[model samples]
Structure formats: C-alpha cells, structure tokens
Target: MGVWHRSLSRFFSPDEPHAAEPQVDQESNLHLEKPISEPLLKAISTNDLPTLRALLETQDRQLFSQIAQNGTPEAAAYLLSRHTVPEDYSQYIGSADPILHPTQYLIRESARYGNAPLFRYLLTQYPAIFSSQRWNNESILLSAMQGGVGIWRVILDYYPAWKDAEFAGHHGCVLEFLVDRDKKELIEFLLQEGLDTDRAGDPVLELARRRGAGKEVLDLIRKYGG
Candidate 1:
C-alpha cells in the first residue's frame, strides 16, 4: 500500500484527539497569519479550485491520506476533479508495481469525504483512479462498501468497471455497508448481480448471520444472498 501512515504519537495526542473535522471555517483561514500548511486546509474548506490544484501538484504523495482526512470536503472535491499526473502514466505501468500518483490522491480524499461530485469526476476524468488500492488491502469497491450506499451509488453509476461489487466474503455478499441506513434496494441490486444465498462471495451476509444481526438486516442479507 502506498498510503502514508499517521505517527502513533499523533494518534494518541491528547491536545488534538482527532476532531471529526479538520477545521470549520475554510475560507477566512486562508488569510490568517498562522502558517503555510494552514492554507491547504483553508483552500479545501472553501472550495478554492485553483489553490487546491497548485498545492496538489507540488505536495508530497506520502502526505496524500493525511490531506484527505484533514482537508475540507469541499476543497477535497475541487482538487480531486483537477488532479492529473505526468504524461508518463503508462510508462510507469510496465514497472513491477504501479503508482497512480495524484489520481490516488483524489481517490483517497473522495473516499474520506464521500463526496459524490468528486467521486463521479474521478470515475469520468480519471477512470484509472478506480484501480488504485485503498487502505487495509481493499479495492475501491471495498471503499464504496465500507462507505455505504451513497458511495456505492456514486461508484456504480460513474465507474461501471466495478466488476467485484459484491464479491464473496465471510458473509457471502450480504455484509455490504449501510446497515444503519438500511440500504435494502442496494442489497437487492447486489443479488441481481448474481450473489446467491451460498457463501460464494457474501462477506456482508456472513457478518450479519454470524453476529446475530437484527431481523431487518438479516432479511436484507438473505434477500440479497438468495
């Protein structure tokens, strides 16, 4: 995984215990006399497309995920739409492994924010972003799965190449995300894709059944599993 890992110290920092968001006001913060790094946050929050573009071009790839987690959802969406790589994208392909560079940046940030516009842009402008790996050894499919139906719909409509939407897993195919939101139609769509009640590829179902998932959730799992 090319993803950057946050320091253990940062994780446990009592002063900044990982607020749900990076900063509230993304616009005014851009002009504050704080620091250079502060602008990145501001640019993201305010949806300053040009500033985000400039920063993404020059920023270190390793810090991509941190930016994703820290940037405002608005700015993240803006930058993701503008991301591009060196002309040698395919040249790097023949190498043993691949690095999608800025495209990966967009994917990570879009996943973090669940921004439909940004995700859709990637699927259109940079189809290659879908192939980029996510953290925890998951694919973009897993990203959408973990993110729930909003993400799922965004990916499905824009990224038709998602052949593994409901691949086999512990729950066969019923362990899809959106448990709290009860994405029943999404589950049914998965079933239409060929995920039967068997354990061929139903991690969602496996998770629900093994954990004694609620009746509605189980019904969803089985409904799709069948």
Candidate 2:
C-alpha cells in the first residue's frame, strides 16, 4: 500500500500554482511519510472495531480485505458481524489490475479463524475467493477441519465453489488426521459429499484408523468405500 496522492481538483485549484517545486520538502528527513490510509491503519491497530465496521461498510470490500492482512484481524472479525458484506464483493477483488491486493489474506483470516458468521457472509458475497483448491498453505483447510461441522456447513451452504476447491486441494475428502483432536462429524460430512477413498495415494479411512480414529468413523469411511 502506497501513499494515495490526492490530485488537486482543477475547479478548486484554478488559481493555485502548479507545483513547480515538485512538492518535495527542502529539509532533509530520515522518517518515511504516512501512507494514504494511515488513519485506517491506526484505527485497526487500536482495535476500534466499531469504527472499522463503519469504515468497511462504506469502503470497497477489497480494501477491507487488505486491511485484514495488516490489522487486528480478530477485532475486524468482530466488526464484520456488525456489517453487511457488499453483494459486489468479487467485483471489488477480482479486478483487471494485476497489482490489486491478493485475495488469500482475507480468505485465510476470515475462514480459518472459525468466524462462522463472517465466513458465511464473505462466501455468499465473494464466491470467487473460495473457488480454488488453495487455502493459504500456512493455515489452510486445517482450520476448517478443526473448527467444526457447523463451520463446514457455513462454507458449503454459502460458497457454491467450495466442493471443487476441496477436491483440488487434494480433495478434502479424507480425515487422515487425528479425529479425536477435532469433531468426528466432519469426516461424516465429507463422506456424504461422495468423497472417494485414496486421495493421491493416501488411503482416506485407513490413515485415520491407523492414527487411532474411532472404529465408528473408520466404519463410516469403509461404508463410503475408503
């Protein structure tokens, strides 16, 4: 994020001299100037969730997404509950401009943190963000897997593109990890989705079973042909 130079309005600056001096200060300085949205930066740092909610409610949603990457994301999530996600969320993010902010930060923070309501709002408003196999590799589906089936429900019911993404991300079909560490029902949900066994050579049910997942879950996996 760079400084957004406010262009002088010709109507208001008709008599004001064009900046022949190049607008550079003569005095030498060591400190960098504030970026354009410094106030927004300051507010999020201060955890001013109310103000954040209001500002995001009015600004382009992608700006909010960018802010999420650098700001107090937990507070932002709280604020998101109070605001309505723009119906045009994708339009704000999927720009023709290649330099536009990346969508990963927003998706990772909102979805991975188990902010079910906020995730739901974003999924409904910005389907393209979740239309791929990739979660931020840093936190990834590991979050949703740990969050709960309710969280999965929030994703699936709202994000129509999620199933394909899950498949592409090695098909979020198998619960090969510790089921005891997370709710068992998520495995069942994946099974019902017609998830096949043997995801890229990882035997879906046996992996979890080997890891001490309950026989009950393993049986469900077998029922699903894992």
Candidate 3:
C-alpha cells in the first residue's frame, strides 16, 4: 500500500476527496482514473440503490460481475442479492485491469471509507471476500488502520488472528502516521489490538519519542509490548 495519488470522484461525491490510493495500469494500458462510464459505478457512487438493482437485473452477467468485483460494500450486497458467488471465482470477479482485484478493492474501499454499517453489511453478506487465503491480510489491516479505530475494530472482531499480521515496509503502517498526528486514542487502540510497534522505517516507540508523544501515550506503547 505504498501511497499512490488518485481521484475520489469515481467512488464518492466529487466534492469529497478520498484518501485511498488511485491506480493506473501502465502495462495493460488501462486508464483506471478515467471518468466513470459504467452505469453500475455511477449508481453505486451516487448511492442509488434502485438503479443498481435495475442494472443488475438488466445488464449482461459478466458486465455486472466486472463492475461489482471492485464495487463498494452496498453495491456488493445488491450484486450478491441477485447473483450467486461464482464457483470458478475468478470467472465472476475480475476486470481488464488485473490490479483492481475485487478482494483487494473491496477491502481497501470498505476499510478506508470508515463506514461501519456498510462494512459490516459486506462482511456479513460476503464473508469469503476477505478470506485470508484469498486476500492480503496486510492490506486489509493497513487500510483498516487508516479508517480509524471503529473500522479497525470491526475487522478485528471478525478475524482475531489478523491482529498480529506483520506489515511490510511498503504497506504504509499507520503507527508512524498516528504518532505524527498525536492520535493517542487510535494509537492506543492499535496497540491494545496487538499491532507490532516494531516497524522497518521507524519503530513506534522511537517515533513517539522523536515526535514528543505525551507520557500517557509512551506508557501505552510500553504497556502493549512496543
């Protein structure tokens, strides 16, 4: 999850810029950043559930499958309502741009958006979407951390083992960001959830010290085995 700049307009109101990384496929020559053309994408971004339902019913199955693969949680639920999860899973959930796999896209969107109800709904409706064997746990964890404590907690409650998932240097661990922002509560919550304070770039304890973390925050890091 090394940072990549992208527009939020494709997934949200144009006025609201999303923090999630934008993607472009150079080799495949897919312009992912291009304006939204798919009707499903427009419907999902606008929260127009009825139009989404109509599109799902009237469109080609593969078209619905391609769009839904990288859709938001609400859109995913609606897509699932009409279509069964594909048995040859890849057949039902891929696009011209392989980088935007549904599993990763869904996790990134659900976690970074910080919508607890929608996140929970997607999890409940399509638990397999985030199965550790299929999706990157590190990506899920990093994105959840960016989403704040509430979203992180939802995923943690669902998959306790992920609490210990080690982050790669490129995954953009949230500890440094949290310490930089002096977000003590979120830092503490992450520590309590058992995220390792030891990172490749800057260990949480050292970063906190350099950033002049409050006494309470330092104590929390140590208390949680930083």
- For model 2 the local lDDT of residue 145 reads 66
Compared with the true structure, the alpha-carbon lDDT of candidate 3 equals 0.56
Candidate 3 residue pairs that clash = none
Best by TM-score: 3
Off by over 4 Å in 2: 1-110, 131-140, 158-174, 178-182, 198-202
Query: How many residue pairs clash in each candidate at the backbone level?
Result: 17, 0, 0
Candidate 2 C-alpha lDDT tens digits along 68-175: 323233334443444453433233332312123323445455455455655565555556555432433213355566555666777667543443343334444325
User: Against the unseen true structure, what C-alpha lDDT does each candidate score?
Assistant: 0.48, 0.49, 0.56
Predicted structure 1, TM vs. truth? 0.46
Clashing pairs in 2: none
**Model 1: lowest-lDDT 10 consecutive positions:** 1-10
lDDT of 3 by residue, 66-126 (tens): 3333344544544344444333323323121223344334445556656555566666666
Best of the candidates, lDDT = 3
What TM-score would candidate 3 get against the native?
0.48
Please provide, for model 1 over 1-226, each residue's C-alpha lDDT reduced to its tens digit, 9 standing for 90 to 100.
1111222213222333553323537653442323456677799899999998777545544344444444344444444445454533222221212125555444545554565555565566655544533221244554555455566677556544452444434332233443444655555565565543454444656655665656876776665553
What is residue 34's positional error in candidate 3, in angstroms? 24
Show model 1 residue runs off by greater than 4 Å: 1-100, 131-138, 159-208, 222-225
